[model samples]
Structures are given as structure tokens and as C-alpha cells.
Target: MGHPTPAAVWIWMFPLLLLESRAGHLGAQETEMLEGQECRPHEQPWPTALFQGVQLVCGDVLIDDNGVPTAVHCKKLKYTVRLGDHSLQNKDGSEQETAVAQSLPHPCYNSSNKDHNRDLMLIPRDRASLGPQVKPIHLADHCPQVGQKGTISSWSCVTSPQENFPDTLNCTEVKIIPQKQSEDAYPGQVTDSMVCANESSGADPCQGDSRGSLVCGGVLQGITSWESDLYGRPERSGIYINICHYLDWTKKTMGSKG
Candidate 1:
């Protein structure tokens, strides 16, 4: 697909903003990959599925001290995280499954709001088995500036909702968009706690991609919160929970929780 102009990007994102209620949950069955490429083994180990039985809702993994960081809204449902597995259907021996002993959503998380600021939660596992294929990622010390590039990885759908989720992991590169652009697209909803990124061609996170990791310079910069479109349109950008803005909260939360 051809790249979308900034004006087109904003125009397309506007209507999506109004669908925030249905857009927020970003259901697993309706998610798609939208122009992303398959990820190589071990290229992104920090992203794992937050699932209840066979159903995948979002992506998550160990961030610090066996704590798994994901979108706070996912806390509403119970999940067992599977790490080191690329294919959700077939798992290699490298995969390790663990039950969540407890969850701690950021104290400031407000589900009633649409911006989804502080959209993060930490799930602590009692006996997590870590190895090369399953390890913790470092949280970024600073938020990426506008125009910086990052890679987002997930195992969600590779096409429209009519298709099945990919058996292998998928990844795509995205550039940080200017805050003003995000503000214009999202209006007063955009906040300091959120960051925005897009591809000129409109590649972005879609449904079932929430809580996925956004990595820049080998650091975990953000977590997928929501996107502008449900069908994985190439003209829309995605919003992420800025890890840098929540560094203190993360540290304190992880330290306090068992």
C-alpha cells in the first residue's frame, strides 16, 4: 500500500477516536497485523500473550523482578502468560507457561477515561522459568522524541479480522509522530502519559495488539494501549503507554508487590 499523507492520517484517525468504547477493548478475535513482517526467533522475547485458556487478549512479559507489564485494562480478565513461544498453536520446548499470582494496575489508571493514560499493569508470577528465549527487557530511561523510530512486535492477526492470528510472531517499524499531530487527531484526549507513532504507509498496532511492547534503541519504551483503527488500516497511528513517564511508578509498584 502507498504511504498516507499526514493530513490523511489525521482525517482517518478522527472517526476512530469516536469509536473508543468498542475500540478500547480491542478484542482478540477481530485483530489483524496490517503490513507487519514476521519476526525472527529471539528477536523479541519480551512479548508474550495474556490469555485466558485459548483466548488471547493482549501481549505481555517480564519487565522487572518477574513482573509482567501489560495494559491495565487487561487486568479485568484472568490470564496465564506464555513466554518463549512464537506460535500460539504449536509450542517448542523453549516455551514456559506460568500462572499470574497477583496483578497490580497503576494506581492512577482510570478505565472511565478514553485517553488510557497510566494504562499499565504488573503481573507477578510465583515460579517463572527464564532463559535466553524468555527474559526481561530494560525499561527506557527516557521517552523517545518525535521522529524517533521503534519496532513493535506481536503475534496477533496478520490480515483483516476475517483471517486467523499468525502462528509466528510479527513485527513492524514505526516512527514517532509529533505530539501536536497526535493531539490534532485525538484532540484533548492526548496526554503526557501517552506517546504516538505511525508509519507513513499507515502501519500500526490493531485489535488484539494491546499490551504489546514498543522497543526503541534496545529499550522498552512503551506498551501498546490502543490504535486509531480496528481493521488495521495503514493510514492510522497507534497510541502507547509511555514507559518513561511511569518509571517511578513501575519501580515503586514492582518493589512493593510480592
Candidate 2:
């Protein structure tokens, strides 16, 4: 799973997005964590690493054991879930790595169709243990307001022509903006389920940075979905699936674990 790239148009390209059409670019998106500083060890206890076996696929949120795994991009393949990981290359001994028994993708997530909403999933494992360095975050109850400040945690590292997928976590500050920007940038692809944001501290999101958390007012409000290249067009904004819009679905879907 990775950030969406230049489509001549805008797209919320799959990091864990469930589209075979989108999976082809996963290798390119895996290049680096976008421009940002390193996150303190375990500071982002809610993020989990998703791997198609040994290879890293994307980063997801750990809301208890009910982590938000997005997309059925590879519907046939299962993922290895790793939590409490500060460094991907070097384990700090606080990591909880396990294989999930099953991944419950949103029943409505058929990205092959005109549907891109409901991309998140509730993953369960036979034995999933939480730790001091691994914890759950509560999803924001309300939609994010325009101009609201938030923090985006990313593992992507993209500094212009240089690209390196850093082992450590990274985070940057962001702000919610009007959806009109999304509409202007992405055209017909923008949906009400999605919200828009712009970089306030670091550079705009890139590959290896999406599908992570967008926390506002201290709650998980959204997930990184896509962005247009703002290198020249600074008016363009990144898109995130507003968690508040899907709160009912997530809770009901997660059921007892929620």
C-alpha cells in the first residue's frame, strides 16, 4: 500500500486499497516515507505494519486488536500484522508480530466498481496480545471541521529525487481543508466519505505515507488516502477518509471488540 501518484488527475491510490489495478504501483510507492522527522520509539503505538508475508505492504491503525486494515487489493493473500514496531529493520523487543486469522474487509468495498469508500477492514487473529508500546486509539466521533489542525503519522521518506524507506516511524502536522479542493483536484472521484487536508508542517504526503492516521483534537479522525502533487500547484490538497463519517459502520462491524 502506498501514496497515489501523478495521474494527470488526482487519485487516492492504494496503500492497502483493494484494487488489483492499483497494486501494480505498490513497488514504486514503497520507495520512501515522505518528508518528516522520526517519531519517538512507540510514540505512535496505534500504527501497525502490514506485510504480504515478509514484504511490507502498508501501515494501518491498531484500534485494540480490531486494526483498520484497508482494501482487499490482493483479496487472495493474507497479511502478517506487526505492532509496537518503532523500527522495521531492528526490533526493539517491544514488537508484537502475528498472522491474522482472517481480514474482514468492508462488505461494500468494491473498488473495481465506482466504489472507493468503505476501504477499511477489521482484522482478527487467533492470538493478538496488546503491549505497553501497542495500544488502541478512539476514532473521532464527529467530522473534522475546516481549518482544524491535525497530525499525520507517516513511514514514507521522499525528499525530492532522493528516496529511502526509513526503518523508523515519522509524523507531520496537517490541517483539514474544504472538500472543494479535492473536487477541484481529483474531479469526479471525490466522495462525501472523504475529507481533504493540506500540509501545515512537512511536505505533502507521498508513497509509504498514506493509510496511516490523521488525528485531530486528540482523536483519530481520518486515514491518509491520496493527494495531488502540490509541488507546483500548492492549492491542491491530500484526501483522507473521514473516520467520523464511518463511525457507525466501524463500530457495528467491529462488534464486541469495538
Candidate 3:
């Protein structure tokens, strides 16, 4: 499955449509072996549901001081973080929900452009506790190499424009695409703060996968941001907000808020 189109396009396509919308480093061979591995229940614990009121539009979880990280575009909601759950429809004892007290999108975030610069936001949770099944993912200390492999997980739609989100969490492997290659595919859209990835076999993050994490070598490298188009085209690569590029800003924001 490939990622779906952006919500902006989905709305025009279907006026009646409802809204919605990683692992460690290893040898090259070892990395290839881990691709597309389905995460066990709460296996990747840091991935929490980012909700806008009642709708799940992105994935988020704790960073520090009860702060959660997600895409800046996701700031448009009265957000909540749902932790420790694999299935959204069926919540077990492990699931915990926390209200967001504050949301701080990056100061340079610009929604009108496709560049996706500083496309990140931090949400402070109210009285949330960290447990075994709910934890924070480490942010990457450096940027990923162009060919490095990474992992992404989400409960978002598997099929584009279809709302076929899985009951359980899903994951896929992706290889980083070089800036030149990404620019060739996206044409003037890939910015320094953005990264691109795609699977040769055609799996991708769609509409519902926004704000999800891109983990590389046990650290978060990116945030699911946007795609080339609204339709799911396997050949088209997906764009992400490069976490490494904004580490200083992230730390400053989180620190200042506290």
C-alpha cells in the first residue's frame, strides 16, 4: 500500500467524505531483513495517537516535561495524546489518554508552502505518567544518510482515500532518498528541513499517517508530513520533516515552555 493524498485534496475529491487523517541501525543485510516487520502489540511504545477532538489525524507521544512532538500542521486541533494502545477501536487496560495543556508549533512553520520547513509541534500533556507500554523515543543526534534505512509505524489508513486504517498498529521500512532524487520527483518542494523516503516495493504513508515518527537506529529521525499528491502512487515518494535539522529549536521550545 502507498500513502494516500493530502487532506486538502481529499476534501475536493469527495465533498461528502469524512475527515480523518522504527528500529536500530544494523548491517546493511540486517537492515534489509527488518524491513516491513509488523510491530508487536505496543512494541514501538512511543507512538501515541494525536487526536483533534475525536478524530485521529496524527501520531504523537511524550518528549519531556510532558511534552509530545508532532507535525506543526497538526496544531490546528484541541489535541490529546492516547498512549499505550495498538488498536484505536478497542482499548485495553494499557491505554491511557492525556489532555494537551499547550501546543507549540515551530516558529518558522509555514503551512502554505510545500517545503515543510520546521514542520513540528510540541504538546504539553496534563498529568500523564510514563509506563512500560508508553514511553518516549530518543531524538536522533545527527541526520540520516541518504541511503540509510528506517522504520515508520502508524494506525492510519492503509489504502489512500479509503479510511482503511488497521485495527492494529502497522509498520514499514523505507530507504532515504537523496535530495537530488527527491527534488526530481517533487520538483522544488524538498527543502533542507525536509527528507524523503520510499520503498522499492511500493509501501508508503498515506493521509492518515501524518505526524507519525520515522525511527532510525533507535532514534527518531523524521515526522510524517506530506506526500507528492493526494492519490496513492507507489512510485511517488513521501516527504517528512527532518528532526535533526530542528533539534536546537525543539530543545529551545521545550525548555522555554518549562
Clash number for each model = 2, 11, 7
| Candidates ranked, most accurate by lDDT first | 1, 3, 2
Q: lDDT by residue for model 1 over 123-222, one digit each (tens)?
A: 8776557677887889898889988999988765566545456777888898988887877776676788888888765566655368367888988888
Q: TM-scores across all candidates?
A: 0.80, 0.77, 0.79
Candidate 3 — which pairs collide? 3-205, 3-206, 4-206, 5-230, 21-57, 24-217, 25-217
Candidate 2 regions with alpha-carbon error over 4 angstroms? 1-35, 74-76, 126-128, 161-163, 200-202, 207-211, 256-258
- Cα lDDT of candidate 2 equals 0.68
Tell me, by lDDT, which candidate is best. 1
Candidate 3 TM-score to native: 0.79
RMSD of each: 13.2, 14.9, 14.3
Q: What TM-score does candidate 1 get on C-alpha atoms?
A: 0.80
Per-residue lDDT tens digits for candidate 2, residues 43-90, read 778887777777777666776565554544423366687788878888
State residue 47's C-alpha deviation in candidate 2, in Å: 0.8
